[model samples]
Target: MTTTAPMKRRAILAFMLDRPGVLNKIAMLIRRKMYNVETLTVCKTTQPGTSRMTITLREDSDDKMRQVIKQIEKSTEVISARELDMNESFWREVAIVKLEADEGRLETLKRTYPFETLDSQGNGCFIVQVTGTSQLIDDFLKDAGSDSIIDVARSGFTAMEK
Candidate 1:
């Protein structure tokens, strides 16, 4: 299957009180709205007492997404919240996929996926790193058929303030 629809990506930024359980509050809102999170990265901000989180949500209409953001801002632990577009901002995610890249297909895989040979010794395992837009990663997986994908770890969406 293929999609001609232009992918809609939104970067949601939140400044929350630096404390325990704040992450849970933020995640609950997304789950309640039934939106699948594409990526979620949280870290401390320059402000000594606050934490910043950037989350990327999968395909959805603008109005519905906006409603979710409003709910996030209304949370008691939330200091501020806003959604951003890729053009107006910059973000990156690291996808580490551990797969069985036997000697027969290593060369072909290197040519196709933007990845690095992390480890190939001892345990007969290899790790690949792919960094790009969500659509690109999604496309890569769709095309990477029958490769014995062992595991996939995405760094989620980490964005800089615009």
Candidate 2:
């Protein structure tokens, strides 16, 4: 009997030279590798000449992941590349979840979960602002399962480098 491994989601951070077309270089690499990037964030780093990029993807095997890592390292614009996981460090992501908690149940729902009213008007429901770790967000959503969820939007994982 053979056991198949599940696709593992990984967070990758890369420091690169700050210049035009830098982001394209990273995106192209992922595209070439046929890896599906779940979320990606790019911003200027403290160093004036450098920038940081964070990417999350699901991989089926470590071997292919390693190959992609090697490719990233070889890129002229990329200074360093790293793969991060929960055990190594703390990470968090922000998301905006909009749902209808019912007019009367608003108080009960807010008390049960961490939520801020974004908009409450003539609309049939309310918009809530939420920011936390992925697990926390998922738990909150699960608890709200009994209620009617109007909409959900997620800003994928934004991790802090070690």
Candidate 3:
């Protein structure tokens, strides 16, 4: 009989040179290592030619995480790569969901989920935006009901340790 280790989620933050194809290269590296990523967010940093990337991945052991970090940091474009814990961090994701309903039903939605108006197409269709943790956004979607959902656009997790 074979026993397999449990897969756990880990967040890795990388500060790298901001250049075209950097994200693609990093993703390819992870894939080459036979690992899959959960969510990845990349944005420019305060430095003129630098960017910060937060990657969520699932791995069976911490040793693999260290290997991935080493491979990432070895890249000329990558300045640093480190693992972070979400439990002691600040992170958020944004989602835009469209709900279809009459003004009365809209009130129910507003009360049920606190979202800002993104657009109102009229004829009982509207787009609303929610910005918060991924869990919070997911909870809002659950309470809003799938039947009422017209569309959904979500951003992945972006984070920093406190």
Task: Show the lowest summed lDDT stretch of 10 residues, model 1.
Answer: 139-148
Best by TM-score: 3
Model 3 scores a TM of: 0.89
Query: TM-score for every candidate vs. truth?
Result: 0.74, 0.82, 0.89
Q: Give candidate 3's error at residue 156 in angstroms.
A: 0.6
Clashing pairs in 2: none
Identify the candidate with maximal lDDT: 3
lDDT tens digits by residue: candidate 3, 1-162: 999876777889999999999999999999999988889999999999999999988885788899999999999999999999768888888899898878887787678667898788998888989988877899988877899898999988899889
Where model 1 places Cα greater than 4 Å from the true spot, the runs are: 1-9, 102-104, 122-124, 139-144
Candidate 1, residue 158: how far the Cα is off, in Å: 2.1
Backbone Cα, N, C clashes tallied per candidate: 0, 0, 0
lDDT of 1 by residue, 1-162 (tens): 987874577789999999999998889889988877777889998999899999887655888878998999999989999887778777877788777757656677667767677777545567777787666676666665446678888788788756
- Put the candidates in TM-score order, highest first: 3, 2, 1
lDDT of 2 by residue, 1-162 (tens): 999886777888889999999888888889988987888988898999999888889886778878888899899989999887657766777767777667766777677767788887545577777778787888777877736676788887778845
Question: lDDT scores for all predictions?
Answer: 0.79, 0.81, 0.89
Q: Give the true-structure RMSD of model 3.
A: 2.8
